[model samples]
Structures are given as C-alpha cells and as structure tokens.
Target chain A: MVDALSAVFQRPNFLAFVIIFLWGFYIMVTRYNLVKKLVGMYLVQTSVIFFLVSISAKKGATAPILLSTTDPVHAINYVNPLPHVLTLTAIVVGVATLGVGLALCSAIYRRYGSLDEEEILKRLE
Target chain B: MSRHFPAILFLLPLFAAISMPVVCLRHRHWSRPISLAVLSSMVVLSILNLNSIITHGEVRYAFSGWSAPLGIEWVADGLASMILVTLSFLGLLALVFAGPTSPKDLGGRIVHYYTLILLLISALTGIVFAGDLFNLFVFLEVAAIASYALIGVAGGRALFAAFRYLVLGTLGASLYLLGVSYFYAASGTLNMADMAEKLPHLLNSKAVVGGLLFMFIGLGIKMALVPFHAWLPDAYTYAPESISPILASLVTKVALVGWVRIIFWVLGAKVIVNDIPVLLLVGILGTLAAVIGAVLALNQRDIKAMFAYGGISHIGIILIGVSQGNQTGFVGGVFYLLNDAVMQAALFFLAGMAICQYGARTVEDVGRIGKQAPWFTGVLIIVAMGMIGLPPTGGFFGKWYIILGALEANNYIAVAAVLLSTLLTLAYFVRLFEAIFRQTPLPSDRLPSDIPFAYKLSLGATSAAVIMLGVFSDPIVQLLLNHALPPGL
Candidate 1:
C-alpha cells in the first residue's frame, strides 16, 4: 500500500488529471448556471486530453522526430507519438463541443431570459 | 471500386453536406432534392454493401494505403453493414418525410437543416463502419454535435433541452475517451482488432478493468439506459417535428450498437460475462430501466413525451437481451434494435403528423382520430400492437427471444421485468388505442388535412417492414445474425 501510494504520488500528472476531472464533474453536477456547466464540461474534456498526452510522457525521452544519427531501434529514447496525435484530435473535438455548448447556452439564454437551471425550469413551467 | 463502398458510404454524405450551402445558393428550393438524392444513394449503397458483406464476408478498407493497425480502417462485417442499411434506409425515409414539413417548421433555416441532417447521417455511417476506437469517438462526437444543433433548431424549450443533451453528451464522450486512453496505455494500440488481441493478456490489469467500467458508464449514458436517461425525454420531446424521428430512432440506437461492439466484439463476452460481473450489472440496470421507463411512460400526457419514454422502455428491453451474454440473447438484442428503430420512427412520424395536421399534441386531443384518418389510425394501431409485443409483430419476436435467453441464463428478475413491462406497455398503449378509437372527439376537433403521398409512402414502408421483420425473423436469425455473432458466442 505504501509503494502504491508513493507510485501514485510520483505521477503527479495522473494525480492532477484525476483531481481536475473530479472537480469538473462536481461543478457540472452542482452548478445551476448553464454557462458554468459548459465550463465544467470543457474542463472535464481537457482533463481527459491531459491524461492522454501525459500517457505519452517519458522521463528523459525526446520528441518522436526521426534522427539520422540516433539509433532507430532504441525506441526508448523517444516519447510515444500515437497518444500525442490522439490528443490533437481530441483537442479539436473538445473545441467543437465547447463551441456547440456555448451556442446552446446563448440560445437558451435568449429564449428563457436566464442561464440558471432553476430559473429556466421555472420559466418553462 | 466495390471494396471502397464503405468509405463512400460516409464520404458521400460528408461531401454533400459541405456543398449543400453552395448548391442551394443558386436555387433555394434545391436543398431538399439534393438531400433526398444523397440519402437515396446512401440507402442504395448501404444495401449493396450489405449484400457484398453477406456474400464475401467482412470488408476492411485502410486509409491512405496504410494497412490495419498502422493507420485508420473501416470494417464492414455483417452487423456493421446491416446497421448501415438500417440507418440509411430510415434516414432516407425520414428525409423524405421531412421534405414537405421542414420548410414550414424551420422557415428560412431549411438549408442549415439539410446540412446538419446530412452531416448527422454521415457521422452515423462513420460510426457503423469505424474499425478503431478513436475513429468511433470522432464519429460519435460529430453525430452528437450535429444533433445538438438539430435539436436546438426548434429554438424554444428545445434550446434548453439541446444544452442539457450537450452537457451530458460531452461528459459521456469525454469519459469514453478517458476509457480509450486507459486502453491505449495498457495495449499500446488504438485499432479495435489489435486492442482485442492484446486485451486478453492484460485482462488481469487494473487499467483494463477500469477502462471497461468507464466505457460502460459512458456508453450507458449515451444510450440513455434508465437512470442515465435524464436527457432523452426532453430532447426527444422538444426537437422539431422533422428531426425527431431521426434523433429518436437512429442516434441512441447507434450508440447502443457501439456499446455492443465494444463489449462483445472488442472486450469479448467471456471477459464481460464470466471474468467480470458486467453482464449481471447490465441485466439489473436494464430491468430497472424497463420497469421504470414503462411506469413513467404510463403517466405522460404529451403524446411525444409518452413515446419518448416508451423509447426508453424499448431500449431497456434491448439491453436486457444484450446482458444475457449468449448467442440467442445477442440475436434478440440486435433484432430488437432494428424493431425499436422502426417502431420509434413510425410512432414519432405519426405523432408529428398528427400535430401538424390536427394540432393534436396530447393523448386526449387525438381522440376519435380513427374515424377521420383511418390509415393513420391503422398505422398507429399496428405500432401499438408491436409495442405491446403482440404476436405477428416485430416487437413480439424480439421479446420472445430475450425471454428465452433470460430463461436459459436463469435470470428470473429480467424475465419478470420483461413480462411486467409487456403488460405495462399493453396498458399504456391500450389507453392510446382507446383514445384514438373510442373516446369522443374534442369540441375543437377539425378535419385533418390530407397527408402528402410521400409521407404516406414512408409510413406504409415502415409498417410493412415491421411486420416483414417478424414474419422473416427466422431467416434473419439464421442467415444474418448467426454470421454477425462474435466469436465464442
């Protein structure tokens, strides 16, 4: 248990990912403002993206650029590139989601005259 | 050229969507025809793809000349191709039904409507064909984004509903991505087939288990399996008339299919059923959804909301079949998926038509509809019978197989849920039938306008397909579903 705790503490990125993710989820569930909820969702998505990018991280590894002088077989010299590529795509999807979410928020605000969840529901009733 | 059909299935719509605005610039009236043409061709191509898959087995197309595992691929197995055919077929019918209706409903935004619909169809096709996890996630997001806009286009309470869907949907997709990240970290590959091959060796790993759990939660939210179903009723209720059937029938169904693929095809049923208690959990949740959705649907006054809740109930039934974790169970689940798609689409279409023609927005308002529009009433009765799981309807066969599977699995709770939900379904639908056939007409009742020929044709086709599915369930199970079954099950 001590070793596992130390290992988890050593990987601060993963720890931070978890913290940020939970924080975002809490805000998403607890917040009444629609825009704040969107912000929470954005944070949640980006935290996941952070986790993905951190999965590719290595202690002393260089970027995955091919070098003529470097030994190609020594793949340990470079960080994994796949997760970086995935993170880029994920980032795009995140931006699109945020854009859509904010657009919906604006529309909701226009129609309901308020962005608070309670206010909107009451008005709807 | 034939091998490229899977790529074309999605690319055709995507390109059409991109060009829809430009095409409509010259002539405002051109958007509907262009959309119809694109969707019709999609249906044709999907049918051809299904035929080829049945004859030649699974087709894999790698992007940019790269082989599988190194680059992205699209796989069209029997199940994927069947889903493709179902999606495009329903999409075509929905688009056809939307043609005359959307202009009046959406006013000047018809162009954007077609664009978003085409984009949604493209994304759905991509989801069906995606051979890798990340590709599936991308397609899922594209579909979600388009649907968010589509739902919001109604621009009232719909906007708030769309916002709610967006929040939950993004969170779900993010969780799914987190799960994918875990899988990637453990397996070092994103290709689904490769990940499957690597997963068994890593089955003991905590990351693998955690990944599976996250994926289920994420997908469960997307598919709106009860408890996670908070967003569905409002989204379905408030969406514009033309868009409701498409969103109601295809979006959630595709997500469920994605979940099945991940659980059965990628993770393998042995792991889910034996190594873990995931199937049991699914069975429990499904039973809850079945009972709860039916009970909630029983109390709804708004016709659309009632059908929306009924949709949740049917999804629960499908999940019950899926959770049984056997070949018969899988067949039942898949069959019910198809049946529910047709049934929900028909119900929403009829509801939308009733609203448009007679301003009948509630069960009480639709009283004596049977006397005025006999054909409409007849279709409603057929759909209601199917929903009640009466024999000779598609819904009956799906439930029959599910019950048989549950009996085989000795899951008595699920069995009771299915039977109880069936009775509840009957009770609610009997009320609808009584309203349509027996109750006196409201004082404000007026003669409904004649429905367009195209609308009638789509309705006729869907109703016929529902019965045909039941009549031919045996052949479908034998010829298609047997092949569609994943290895071991």
Candidate 2:
C-alpha cells in the first residue's frame, strides 16, 4: 500500500497539470461573461502554480533547503527546491496577470455597461 | 562586480516598471521620460556587458547565489542582450511619441496609459532575459496582461477586441504553463540548461512531445501566426491610435522571442526542428499562413486592420525561413523579425497620426483629406512604400534575405510565396497611397493645421530608419547573426 502510494505521489505533478490545463480550457471556451473569464484565467494560472510547486515535492523529502548542520539534504535529504524558487517568479507573474486582467475587465464594464460577450459583439458590429 | 550585473539584467526593468506608477503619483508628467531614461540606460548597460557574454559563452546569474536546478537564475548572453536592446529602444521611442500626443483627448487617463506601457516594457524586457521555463511564463504573463489593458483603454469596441484577445491570450498562456509542467515532470528540473541536458534522454516521451505541441500552439497564438490570428486584426483596429503602433511593432515580436527561446534553448533546436512530426507541422502551418495572410489582407478596409493582416503575413514569411532550421535560414528569419516590426510600426504609426488628425478610422473615411493633410500624407507615402517592401527600405532587406535563404534551401514553395506576398503587398499599398495622396482638396478643411514637431520628428526618424536599416542591412544582419542565436544551434 505504501509502495503504491509513493509511486502515485512521484508523478503527482501530472495530475496537477492536467486539472489546471483542462480547467483553463473550460473557462476560456465555455464562459461568455468577461469577468468570469478573468476568474477562469486566475484558476488556470493558479493551476500552473500548483504544477510548479508539485515539481518540487518529493515523496519523503522536505523542501530543498539547508537550515542547519543537522539537516539531511545537506548531501541528499530534501527534494529539489529550485522549482519552488522559480515558482516565486510564476506567482509574481500570475498576480500581475490577474491585476491587469481585472483592471481591463473594470474598464470594459465601465465602457459597455456589461461584460457579456454577446453585448460587446453587438456594439462592435 | 560585472558578473553579477548580467543576472540583474531582467531585474532592472522589473524594478523600473514596478516603480513607474509610484513615480507618476509624485509627478504626473514624469512617466515617459523616466521609462525612456531607464530603457536607454539599460541599452548602454547591455552594450557594456557584450564582451563578457560573447567570450565566456552563456552566462547564468542564479538568484540567491544558488546554481541551476536549485534556484532561479537570469541568463543574459549576447542573443538576450540584443533582443533586450531592440525591445527597449522601440519601446522608448513609442513612449516618446506617446508623450507629445496631447493627453487632453483621453481626459485625465494619460497617467494610466503611460504607467501601464512602462510596465509592459519591463515585462517584455524580463521575458527576453529569463533563464528558466517558469521565469519565461511569469514575464510573459506580465507582458500579456499589461498589453490587454493597453489594448482596450477608454473602451467601446476596444472592449470587444480586448475580450477576444484575453480569451486567446489566456489559452496560449495556459498551454505554455502546461508545457512547462511536462518539462518539469519529465526532467525533474525547470532550469533551461538542465532541461537541455535531460531532453535528449526523454526525446521519445509522449508527454514531452505533447508539451512541445502545447508550447508552440500557445506561442503561435501570441505571435498571431495564421490560424491563431483572428484576434489580432480587431485588437489592432480598435486600439487607440496612440497604442496601435506599439502593438503593431512590439507585442508579437516579443512573443516570437519567447517562442524561439523555448524551442531552441530548452527543446534544443537540433532535436525539435528535426523531429519529423514537429517539422512537418511547422512547415505546413507556416506555408498556409504565408499564402493566406497576404491573400486575406487585400480585403481589409481599415488602414490599421490591413496593416495588421499584413503584419501577420510577414510573420508567416519570417517562419518560412525559420522552419528550414538552418543557421542561414534562421538568421534571416530573426533579422526579418526586427526589420519587419520597425517598418510595420513606421507605417502604422503614421496611419495612426492621420486617423487622429482627420478623425478617420477607415481608408474610405480619409477620402480626399490628403489635401488637408499634405505633410502627414507625404510621410505616410514613404512609410506605405516601405511597407510594400519597396527598394531602399528595411522591409526590402527582410524579404531579400528570406528569399535568399529560401533559395539556398532550394525550397521553391517558400520562394514563390515570398514573391507572391510582395506583389500583393505592393498592389494594396499603391492603391491606398493613391487614394490618400491624390490632390483633391476639401471645401471645409477643419483638420489640425500643425502636428507638433515631436510627432513629426518621431515619425520622420522611423521613416528614415526604414531606409537606413535597409541600406545598412549588411552590418545589422551581420551583428544580429553574430550575436543573436547561439553560434552553432
């Protein structure tokens, strides 16, 4: 049982990535409302955050960090922490995207008095 | 001291962009000057770092002093530096042009406009210098989000265009993130160099190939290549005259750098380009886009929209050379990317100024305002010719090299499309010019009598630059060839 669980956990990132990509696709294509689409974008980007973080997670290892002489991964105790650091960059990006996306949504709402794609399209036409 | 500077290459713009708004609050008129000052200073800094980049080969600046596979790093070598300068300079010039275009038209919103543009510039700069898969995505998000806001300001139909862009843009970003996840899981590392090392061993993995497909599709959407380009025309057509030129010139070009970087550096060009399915897919999409973009461009009525389609066509042409996957061919493609943006922006910016001056949105709307706007008309004519790839223009060199590269490859289809697009380009631009420049004076000429010298100076500089870049294509191409795209790959 433990072995099966370890094997599954080893590839846990695949699960996180699939869920995120599919969620993003659903929101992008199916949603007609503008702000909802931005929400979907946030969901999608957060999924990427999950994937990047999962890349650093190990079955039995702590984060790839060295706190003291007692720490194990001093040689090989912890999991890879590189991706965790990289995800800091990703999180920053995600926040910026969300901020800009919401800002544009507000601007759109102000201009058209609606965020419906059909309503916007009617005006454009 | 110098070794550390390259690492902070991306961090500089990142800081400048984050601070532009803060600065604007203290002094509202300060955004453009500060953004330009920061960007120009960066150009000088990059130039100073060239030798370190070229001699030592790829330099990696790891954050927190940790090595790749353990920490985030910024990689700025020759290619990244060159791309940085190109993006920053164009960004600065666009900011300069935007500065003098009276903000009174937009009421009090100029602050919002300049501030967001500075942020966009920073994001574009960071993406060029990112050394890891995750950093690339992060910076791309910053750039894309800012660009979406830049596109639809003061709303109206601009909102429609921005919505279309947001839908497609989000899809592209997610696809890229998905690809990054696959690369991470497969290699267990997100650093570009580490991935390059692990890539050969995982060449046959279905997950890896799927990742490549997702990434290319995503970048393709951002670059507005062929099938993914439906959002671009509307976005460009509806964006304010002030923002149109920047979008026309820089947005797709930066995404192209990200596309090339991921494909070449992370995937390792030799493997990705040679892999049968990937090659075939790229070639097919590229060929179709090449033929279709030009043919479809002929039908556009809006001046900006037509140029947007034309820009898409040039993008397709650049790929024709790129898909060949040879040094000569790829170099032509990259150089063309630079030249294409410059010429396309020169033409588009002038048209934008005309639109602002005459309150005209479409070609037919401008009718005989040529007489009312003679000086603007003359500059527009030079730009229009350059757009058509006429001789003594930068546009011509991009076409010349692509054709030469195709001929070297003995690829007849590419050669045919190159020639065909030029003819189609000329056909459209000539008629548009005649309509705009034909001497039909209006009875009630109420257009602005004089556009500020700053506007004229910016346009004239770019127009002259089109011809100068063409005439000096030899040196520019050589410099780019020497610097951009690693020596062998």
Candidate 3:
C-alpha cells in the first residue's frame, strides 16, 4: 500500500487529476447553490482536460513540430499532438456548456429570486 | 452529387441552420417554407441513401480525401441509414407541427427555435453517421447544446429544467469524453473500426475496462435508464409543446444508438457478455428500469410526464433486449428502438392536440374527449393499445420479439419483467381511456377546436406508420436489421 501510494504520488499530474475530479464531484453533489454546482461542473471538466493533456506529455520531448531534420520513425522526440487537439475541442465544449449553464442560472434567479436548489424547488411548488 | 449524399445528409441542415437567422430577418414567413423544404429534401435523401446502402453496401466517406485512422470518416451502414431515415422523417413532421403554431406560441423567438431544431437534427444525423469516437462526442455535444436551448426557450420552469438537464447532460458528455481518452490511451486510435480491430487484443487491459465502464455509465445517464432518469420527466414535460414530440421521440433514442454503437460495434458482444458480465449488469438494471418506470408512470397525473416515464420503461425494454447478447435479442432491440420512436411521437402529438383543443392539462382533464374529436380519440385509442403492447400495433411486435429473445437467452427474469411491465402499461392506459371515454367533461371546459391541417397530417401519418410497422415487421427485420447485425451476433 505504501509503495502503491508513493508510485501514484510520483505521477503528480495524475494524482492532481484524481483529487480535483473527486473534489468537483463532491461539490456538485453536495452544494445547494446552483452556481456552485456549475462551478463544480467546470472543475470536473477542467480535471478531465488536464488529464488528457497530461497523457500527451513525455519526458525530454518537445512540441509536435515536424521538420525535414526530424526523424519520423523516432516519434518519441515529440509529444503526441492528438490528445492536445482533442483537449482543445473538449475545452471549447466545456466553455459552451459553462455559458449555457450560467445563462440558465441567471434565468432561474430572475424567475425564482434564488439560486439555492431547495429554495427554487419550493418556489416551483 | 449522389456520391456526396452521406456528407450532405447532415451538412444540408447544418448550413441551412447557419443561414436561417439571416434569411428570416426580412421574410419571416419564408422560414417555415425553407425549413419544410430542407427537411423534406432530407427525408428524400435519407431514403435514397438507405436504398443505395441496401443495394451496394456500407458507404464510407472521409472528409477532404483523408482516410480512416488519420482523419474524420463518415459511415452510412444499413443501421445508420435506417436511423437517419427515422430522424429526418420525424424531424420533418416536427417542423410541420411547429410551423403554424410556433409563431403564435413562441412569438419573436420562432426563428431561433427553427434554427435550433435544424441544428439538433443535423447533430443527430452526425451522430448516426459518425465513424470516430471524438467526432461522435462533438456531435453529441452539439445535439445536447441545441436541446438545452430548445428546452429553455419557454423561459419559466422550463429554464430550471433545462438547467438541470444541462448539468446532467454535460456530465454525461464529459464522462464519455474521458472514456474516449482512455480508449485512445489503450489503443492509440480514435476511429471506431480501427479501435474495434485493436481492442480485442487489449480486452483485459485496465484502461480498456475502465473506458467501457465509463462509457456505459455516461450513456446510461444520457439515455435515462432509470437511476439517471431524474432529468427526463421535467424536461420533457416543461418543453414547448411542439418541441416535446421531437425530444420524446428522437433525442434519447439517438443517445441509445450511440451506446449501442460503442457496446456492440466497438467493444463486441463476447467481451461485454462473457468476459466481463457488462451485459448482465445492463440486463439487471434494464429490468429494474422497466418496472420502476412503469410504476412511476402510473402515478403521474400530468399526461406528458406520464408518457415521459413510460418512455423510460420502453428504453429499458430495448436495453434488456440488446443486453441478451444474441441475434434474436439484437434484432428485437433494434426493432423496439424504431417502433418506440413512432409510438412515443404519436402519443405526444395526440397529447398536444388535446391540450390545444380542450385545454387539457391532466389525464383527468381530457375526460369525454371522444365526444368532441371522435377521429383523434379513435387514433388515441389505437395508440394507447399500441402502448400497452396489444396485437396489430407496432408496440406488440417489439415486446413480442423482446420476450422471445429473453426466453431464448433463458433469462426468465427478463421475460417476467416484460410481462409485468406490459400489465402495468395496460393498467395506466386503461385508466387514461376511462378518463377519456367514460367521464363527463367539466361544464367550464372549452368546446373542442379544430386542429390544424399539419397536426392532422403528421399524427395520421405516424399512427398509420405504427400499424404498418407491426404488419410489416418480418420484412423489415429480414431486409435491414439482419444485414445490420454485428459480426459476432
């Protein structure tokens, strides 16, 4: 168990991803405020994005720039660019979701005058 | 031009959606005509595409001349084209229902509504045709975002419902993306066919197993398979009248299609069924969803909410069929998917009409509806019988096949669940019909108003299609579904 913990801690980014993801999930489930829930959602998304980006990283690697001098066969010299590209798309999706979430929050506040989930449910009733 | 049909199947609506706001700026009346024209053409193209697939084989098109495992690919196999036909046809009908009524109901926001409708349809098409996991994720998000706006367009309790849906939906999508990432880590490929080819060797890899688990949970939430169904009832109930039919019939079905693709096509049946017991888990949960949904549906006074709960039960039945992991089960699941789409759309349309004509809000409020609109009430009775899985309607055949599949798989528990849910469905519909035919309408109830020609056309066509599907189930399965079955199945 100690060895496993040390090994997991060695990969700090993965540890960070796990911790942040759990934190976000915890907030999302436990928070009463809708905005806080939205924030938690954002954090959860960010952690996933971080994990994706971290998976692309390699030691002693540079950016994925192919030139005439670079050997295509030894691809480990450069980080995998695909995950970066995917994370870019994921980030855009995350932002779009955040914008919609915030808009809904404001709309909910306008009608119910509160962003607390319980209060809003009471108003709806 | 014909060769480009796969690309144009989705791009047409997407381009039209992008140009809609600008086009509607001056000639607002043109929006309906343009939307109808585009959707009609889509229905034609989808039919033609299905024909071509039937004649030749699966059509594959890589964007900008880039092939698989390198760039994005779009595939229109037998199953994809069939779903495309269903979505585009239903989308056309929805736009028709929304045309005359929306301008009155939505006021100035009608243009935005049309745009989002087209966008949603386009994204759904993209999902059906997607050959890569990342592309599927993007399209899923596009469809989801469009639905969020569409649901919240009514702006009251609807906004809150949309918010709830948005939160849950985004979480689901993110989990899906995470799953894709894990798959990518394991296989180093995002193309589904390539991943499928590669995944067998890595079946025992922790990353692959984790990915499958995440993907199933994510899609389970998206498809609202009972435990994750908290977001569905309110969202479907509070959506604008015209939008509810489309949401009811298509959105969750499309999500289920995604789930089916990943599970059956990418992961393969042997792994899910024999190796890991994922299918067993799905089967058990599906049985749970079927019973729970029916019980919840029986208690709902609101008609749309009741139908929404019933939809969950139907989805559960479809999942139960698919999870049985046999040829008969696969075909039954696929057939139920198609049949339920038509039945649910018809139910919602009839409910909308009742709301429009008699101001009926609850099931009880629709009392004596048969006295007012005899023809529609007749259609409603047929549809209700279909929902109860009676013979001569499509729903009966779907349930019949699923029960047969369960028996074939020796899953007596699933067979019992199907039978029990059918009885529960009968109970609810019997109650609804009693309210419709037996009770007297309140004196303050408004006189029945004439439904629009569009409503009559769409509803009639859908109900007719339901009966036709039952009558023609054999040919459909033989011609399309058998060919669409995955190799192992």
**TM-scores across all candidates?**
0.97, 0.89, 0.97
The fraction of correct interface contacts reproduced by each prediction comes to 0.93, 0.66, 0.78
Ranking under DockQ, best-scoring first? 1, 3, 2
Indicate the worst ten consecutive residues by lDDT in candidate 2 chain B.
Answer: B272-281
Q: Which runs in model 2 stand beyond 4 Å of their true positions?
A: A1-20, A53-57, A63-77, A83-92, B1-12, B46-60, B102-105, B272-280, B437-439, B487-489
**Model 3: residues >4 Å from true position, as ranges?**
A69-73, B272-275, B442-446
For residues B1-489, write the lDDT of model 3, one tens digit per residue.
666899999999999999999999888878888889999999999999988888888888999999989999998888898888988988898887786567655646878898999999999999999999999999999999999989998687889899989989988988888899899999999999999999988888889888877888788888898999999999999888888999999999999999888887887886743365777888899899999999999999999999999999999999999899887888888888999998889888887777765667798776656567775687888888788888898888888888888999999999999889999999988888888778776666557476789988888888898899899988887865646887687
Residue B113 in model 1: lDDT: 95
The residue-by-residue lDDT of candidate 2 on A52-117, one tens digit each, is 776667566776457686745453567876667767777776776667667777777787788898
Worst 10 residues of 1 chain B by lDDT: B270-279
TM-score, A chain, model 3 = 0.93
Residue A120 CA displacement from its true place in model 3, Å:
1.6
List the candidate numbers ranked by TM-score, top first: 3, 1, 2
lDDT of 1 by residue, B216-307 (tens): 88888888989899999999998989999999999999999898888777888767433656677878888999999999999999999999
DockQ per model, Cα: 0.89, 0.51, 0.85
What class would a CAPRI assessor give candidate 1's docking? high
